[model samples]
Structures are given as structure tokens and as C-alpha cells.
Target: MFKFWYANQQNRVRWANSFSAEYRLECGVRQGGLSSPALFNLYMNNLIDELSRTGIGCHIDGVCINNISYADDMVLLSPSVRALRKLIDVCESYAATHGLKYNATKSELMVFKAGSKTYNTIPPVMLCGRPLNRVTNFKYLGHWVSDDLKDNADIERERRSLAVRCGMLAHRFTRCTTQVKVTLFKAYCQSFYTCSLWVNFTQRAYSGLRTQYNNTFRVLMGMPRFCSASGMFADADVDSFSTIMRKRSASMLRRFRDSPNTILGTLAERWDSPILGRWIRLHAVK
Candidate 1:
């Protein structure tokens, strides 16, 4: 396997001079290539498997989930601070053995329920003998995740971002047709609100988001702020904001249900009661 990987990697070259000086890559996968992510995942799988054998991950319904990874980003979870530290040690050791190094500056430690008063009790975590900074909230994959898992802060941030984008769009596309404006709104503005897969929208949160959506449509249609948005929505032939969010949530749940033996599937199974109950309620209402 090592020989094959090295052989395939030898073809990678970069020019050091305008025409003649070429250097061959002897190690590390190429960045931004389509195959790089898969290759990296294959290399990291061994380390993850080793960690799994140590049984130091979060356990739920007899299933152990130590980490969730997508491409190179990973989120590690443990039930206790000691176990989390051990996992970090294992990761550092594995990286050293594999000719890789962890960027301690980019790493952060967060303890759930470790509020301001009790946060000091949680011990420090070190990478390369340097302590990692602790944070009360962190952004992961475009979503703001807080210790309490509340969506208020994240929602407000997204709302402001969307508002700015809408203003820019309206300014630049003033001469665009109504249909074109609608298309752009759906493509650009809607994605910011819908991309957060883990958001559990409460009534208040949904209402706020709905208002933003209406204001966006009103701006696109050149309608007065006080006018009813329903007419513009009907002209655009787009579903209501709540309906779109509900469909997205339901689609995500269905995908989780259909996936078997994976991390998400295991989570869905463990939370079967609430997930299934929601599904039933949704269908009944339909």
C-alpha cells in the first residue's frame, strides 16, 4: 500500500522556475484535488480505528461515537475531561507517527454545561505541550454551536448576514426583471437560512426567520414594507418560508432514518421515540 501510494504521488510536480526547474512531491497528498479528500480519509481511518479500540468515545445506547468528520474537519466528543485529554494525546501521537502535525492554534476546547462559574474546574488540554484555548461557543461548518445548543445567537447572526446580502442584491440588480430577482433570492439568500442542518426551529425563531424572508421578497418585488407579502409570494410561486423549512427538516430526518449502521443512523435510532413521533405528527397534519 505504501509503495502504491508513493508511486501514484511521484507524478505530482510543481515548477520552481518559469520553464525548467521542476520539483517532485515525495510525501503528502495534493491539496484541493478531488482525490485528496478520499486519500486523506483512508489514511486517517487507521488512526480512528485505533482510537475506537481504546473505547474512549461518547457512548449512547451501546454505540460509541468519538468523532464526527467531514473531509479534514473533525469534532471530538467524550463524556469526561480526562477521556477527552487522552483522545487528544492519541491524536497527537498518531499525527507524529504519520509525519503530520496538529495545528494547536486552530484547536479549541469546549466543555458542555461548563458555564462561567464552573468552567474553571475543567482541566486544560495541551497539543504539542501548548494549551488549547477554551471557548463557550464555536462555529463549525457554517453553523454556530453553543454549549447550550440554543439557536438564538446563530439565528441572529444569519439574519444579519442575510440582510446585508439582500441589500447588496437589491442595489446591484435594480434593473433585473421580477422573475430574475426571485431566482437570485432563492439561490443566494435562501441557502444561508437553510444550510444549517442541525437547527431545531422554535416558534419564536421561526417567526423571526419568516419576517426576514418576507422582507426579502418585498424588497425584490419593490413592494412597500407595510404591504402584505402574500401577493408577492403568490406571484413568485414560491412556497411559504415555514413550509420550505418544514420540508427541509423532514427530508433530513428521512435521510437519517434511511441511513443504516452509520453514525447518524445510530443517533436516529437512539432517539427513535422523538424522531418517529415527530414524523407521525407531520404526516397526520399533512
Candidate 2:
């Protein structure tokens, strides 16, 4: 049945209102197909298993946590530079054997260390015959990840997004009715989706975010810039900034506790760890 569905798949391109001749797909699945990610996962399972057998990446209590994968986005984690290079070598070999290739230009290497000029001293990691860029921070899956592993960059990103949304709302929807404005505000503005994962950010950064969140509602409602936001959220029937973060983080903790995967569940067990403990203390359900 699978062969019948996948065999002799043909595709064509449409450009300038003209149709090109269909060509047989010699390899790879259809892009954006529902099963593409699953098929890709199946194809990459052998590489994952090989990496596991090597036992060269980060591990926690006898569990191999060398990699984090989501569809095609994969992040390799290792405690030391040597182990990381080995993991990259293994990935390169597997990609060659499987007819897959890594784009060295898009790839970046970041080392997590405190006050160390590691990038200057360490040799570059090569992929596809090109060296990967060494970066202090990079965006992954919509969140900014830094070598310091702090949440400040992501928070600043969210704050900037909020400011842009606020200006859009004020300019585009100034004459909108209160009900319409409220609806649009909730849809466009209250998007602190990654707040639950914020742990290592400073108080000032969070306060700035709160200021922006309040300003968004104020501008949408045509209220004074310095007006108190104490009653604004209640009047708008929307969640407050603190409430949003608290609720999301609580849900995250619950998921961690109830996750079927033992490694994920271990995150909840380590609630007292420096990272998780700060999150729990600041946002856990009272």
C-alpha cells in the first residue's frame, strides 16, 4: 500500500500562468505533505540510533540527552567541545550516507561558558567543507537562545513585538468600537506565547515587558499614556500581564509533571534546580 502511494510520484511547476511538464520524483517525499515530517523522522531514526550508541553527548543520570529534535530542526548538546565535534562528524557521515546535506552557512556553533573567550581560542567546527558561524545568540523555533542561556533576549524580542503591535492597533483601529477594539487587541497583542519558558531574565526586563503590555491596551483604548492599568485589563475582559505569565507557567509545570517521557518528567523532579526553581517560585500556582 505504501509503495502504491509513494511510487512514481510526479510533480509540475506553474509559473507565469504556464504549466510545466510533470516529472517523476526520483527521491524525497512531497514538500508540505501531512506525512512528510513522519517520513523524515523515520529516515533519520537510524542516525539517531547511531548517535545514541556512540554515547558521546550530554547525558543525565544514565539517559542519553544528546539531541533535541523537532521535525527538521535539530540541536545537538554536548558538555565539551571535543564531544560536540565528534557528534558533528557523526552527523556529517550519516548525512553523506543518507543523501542528506547540512547547510554550513545556516549552521552556527555556540559554546555555553561563563566569561570565557572560547570562540576566539577554539578551532572552528567544519561542515560540508565550510566552517559554521560562531554566534553569541541565535533564533531557534521563534525563540532567541544565547550562549549565556539567559531569557533576556527572548523577552526583549517579545517586548519589541508588543510595541509594534501596539502602534499597529493605535494607527489602524483608532475609530474601532470598544467591543471591536477589545476583540482585535486580544487577537493581535496578547501574544506572550513563550513566557512560560522564561526563567533567567532580570526583573527590569520583565518590568519592561509589563510596561509594554499595559501600553498596548492603553493605546488601543485611547487612554492616557501614563494612566493606571489597574482596571484596564478587567474592563477589557482580558488577562493581565502577570496573570498570563503565571497561568502559562503553571500549565507548563503541570505538563512537565505529567509527561509520559521520563526525561521530561525529570525536569519537574529537578524543580529545585537553579533554572526551574526560579520559574516555579515566580510563577507556580499559589
Candidate 3:
């Protein structure tokens, strides 16, 4: 897929008042001086190239559940654990060749259902969060299996977007030479101070649950939640900081055609190469 930097990482908040910058910058393209949005696709493409000669389509394998492949979490429809294990082998091999590590604990598999369709979902990871759910967040191919009541995640996202804009605006005003009383306002006005409260409240709750009520997390909170809190929200509950999966869409995988992270482009190429497909199926897929 044509992966773009997420909104959070794709920030254009003016950092310097002395120099008016573009309020909005499209990331992924190499631009001089701007480094907020790391061009992660460059690295992913390298991995794709390595796997293409291996003769594996990775996820193009068939998944059947209730007789339909369309699912909020279609990846979970692999029929049995053996199939999932095969998928994992493909993943490990891909990681090994690309000089990357797949954190298995975080790189787990979960199954969810909406109506009759099954979904496969991946929550966010620690340290460096991936966009498994958002354009900026690490979404597996930028999509996941989610349920109907999960609208709260979008609400949380809106709250976070507000905070980023407000934080940037507050910082801009504080640094502007033309803006009078910069010092006075910095010391007195708590304008930007409270902007992240919503972000914090949800984050704190997630943290609290992570340590004590992890098992009963959903029951305790009485609802499913996702964190879009900027770095401001630290120590969140396990899945609180993820974009849960939703109905699968071809559009979601459309970006895969050009993204650096395509398992198909890499593995399929390798599979098409003579001898590699036999090697993997005989040795790796055992």
C-alpha cells in the first residue's frame, strides 16, 4: 500500500515563529531539514525485495470461515493453528533476511467476529509504536478487525488531534517576538497546559488497568478503548493504544501495491524464483 506518515507523526505544527513554515507537510517524500516523519517505507521496501525471491505469497494463502473471506479481521480466518504457524514462519523468514526483528510477544494473533465474519487484529507495540491502526500508527497493512461499538476509538482520536493543534499553537505564541507578554503569558496562561487532559485521563486509566486489572480489562472499563494520546500519554494498558481491526477492505491493501512493507511483493518474487519455494515449503513450512 502507499503508506503515508500518520497524522501524529505527520505533524506540521510550526516550531519557529521567526520562520513561518508550511502548516501542512506531506511526508514520505524526502524533504530537506524535516525529520519528524521518518521515511519507514524505504526500509520496508528493502525487506520486500529480499522476500520476493523466496517463492512465498505470505498472506495470499486462503482463509475460510463461515464460507466468506470478507472479515473485519480476515487474517484470523486461517482455519487452524497449523496455518497460522505457517504464516508465522513466513514472517520470521522475512524478518531474518531484512535484518529486522519481529517481537513475537507483541506480534501476536487474535480473532474477533462481527456478524459472521472473522477478523485478525494487532494492537500497538511498545517503545516505537507502529501504524497497525492509523496512517501514522503502525497498522498491519493499515487495517485491522474491529467491532461495531468501537466508535470510541475515533472519539479518542479527535480529542488527540485537538491537543496536538493546541499544543503547537501554544508553543508558537510563546516564541513569537511580535507576540507581546510572551514571558508573562508563559508564566501565567495555562492555555496549553490543560489541552492534553483528555489525552491523559484515558492514558492514566489504561496504565492503571495494565498493572492491576489486565485480565478483566474490558469488563473493568465497561467498554473497548484505543489510545491516540500523543507521547504525552505514557504507560498505557496493553491494547488501549491500538487501532482495533474492522471489516476488511480491498482499499486497505491497495496501498500494499506501492508500500515498502508488502509481504507479497517480496515473498512472491522469491517464490517465483526457482528452488526457493520448494526450500521454504519443505523446510520452513514443516
Candidate 4:
């Protein structure tokens, strides 16, 4: 009977989950996921504990160049294959300590500095499903993510997120009267002012809320006067805006604006009073 709603969407959302016993294999540039750190840490911690239980001889946080060495990844130096074997025993024992097991399939062991006068063979094992013979780059955390990759990912992630936010505004954000959603919109607007270079992040956020509430509160509630510009907090660029006096912190003001709590946590901060002048002076000292 209802043509518009029925034609527009389905009543249920069918989700496909990954729980199949059969392996699924696809290869491309495997980008690091957002939750990779927490996941990798859990996996590594298990392996480390397992190796320790087997009476291993590896250092906990290995350091070669004093301060230059990073976390977790270790470099073991030995003269002979026998020494490397001993190191492997240590690794297995360590694994057993934490109720974990590390078979060869999931581990990659590589021998470096082989048959050299100055440097003996250095063997290192990669934790994340690396091939013993074929593995070229090391896995730091869950990614083969290097500093260069991180720099690219940082910018790329930010840009893609902006696009996603724009897409959300383009599609899903149709319904309203959600106090929680309204609060989120208000919070983002109050935190940072984004304008162009990426879906006009700050401006788009404001424009979005207004567009959704075009019927009732758009023109009225969404004003720079009543609604402070996020730039008032983000770019503060005090030199750029000389009109704002050293009255209150831009962040404090922003927080107050976002949160519905009218009664400030402190009695002095609750209301605008002469004591606020003294409070401001105290803040300046610190």
C-alpha cells in the first residue's frame, strides 16, 4: 500500500559475517586497519609469553643502538646456527608462558649477517603470518606500515574520513529528532572549524545540521552569533582575531557549548561573576 517507503528501502539489513572454515585468499595492497594496534598487541603478547615459558635466552626489550631501538621487535646476534637454535628454544619457551603456541606456519625466521667476518648470522622471526623464505619486509605491529606509510596513511585516512562524513551527509542523515545525534553534531561544530581541503569539514558539519533541520531550527539556531564558530576554538589564531579578549579559554568555552551541563563542575565556574576574573588571573599564572 505504501509505495514510497517500500520502493525506497528494505525492512531488514542482511549482514555477511566471516566464520567459514574454508580459507579465503585474495591479494592486493593490504592496508593496515584502524584497530590493528590493539589486535597485534594481543597476538604478540601471547607469543612472547609462550616463548618465555620454554626457557628462552632472548632479551625482553632488545636494544642495539642504545636509544635507537624501537619496541617489541628484537635483533639477536650469534656466531653459529647452534646459537640461533638456542634462541629458537627460548622463543618457544616464552610462547608457552602465556598460554600460547607458535608453529612455523604463522612464524617467519630469517638468517642475516651470514658468513661475514665482522657480523655473525642474525636471525629474526616475524610474528604475523610471514613466509620464512619469501618475507622481505618486517611487520611492525600488524602492518608492514613504515614511517612513510604512516605519513601517507595519516593524511589519506583523514581525507578519506572527510569523504565518508560528506557521504553520510549526502545519504544516511535524513531522519531527525535524535537528541544524541544533535549533541554529536553540536560537539563537532564546537570542537574544530573545518572549511574545504576535505569536504569543508567544519563548515559541512554546520551546514549538515542546518539542512536536516531546515523546517524548524536551521535559520534560527544555526547562526554564528548564537552558535560560535568552531574556528573560535580551533584556529583561535589570536593574532587574526584581536576582538576576543583574554576572557575565557576557547576550549573551556567550546566544552561548555557542547555539553548540556549548565552548572559548571566548580561553584566558581558555575556562573559569570567577578570571581571569574580572579580565576582567570590564576589560570594565567599557571
Which candidate number has the best lDDT? 2
Estimated TM-score for each candidate? 0.83, 0.89, 0.28, 0.29
Tens digits of lDDT, candidate 4, 185-214:
443322222211111124454444433332
Kindly list the per-residue Cα lDDT of model 1 for residues 1-286, writing each as its tens digit: 8557656553434467445444556677777778787888898998888778778888877778898777678888998888988888888889999888888899888877743434555677788888988887898877788776557767877778878888988889989997898888888777655332534447686567679888987887688998866776777787766556567667767788798756777766664555455554555666
Alpha carbon lDDT of each predicted model? 0.75, 0.83, 0.35, 0.38
Candidate 4 — number of clashing residue pairs? Answer: 18
Clashes per candidate (backbone, < 3 Å): 0, 0, 34, 18
Model 4 residue 157 distance off true place after TM-score fit, in angstroms? 2.7
- Model 4 has an lDDT value of 0.38
Clashing pairs in 2: none
The true-versus-predicted C-alpha distance at residue 70 of model 2, in Å, is 1.0
Candidate 4 local Cα displacement, residue 274, angstroms: 42
Q: Which ten residues in a row have the lowest lDDT in candidate 3?
A: 63-72
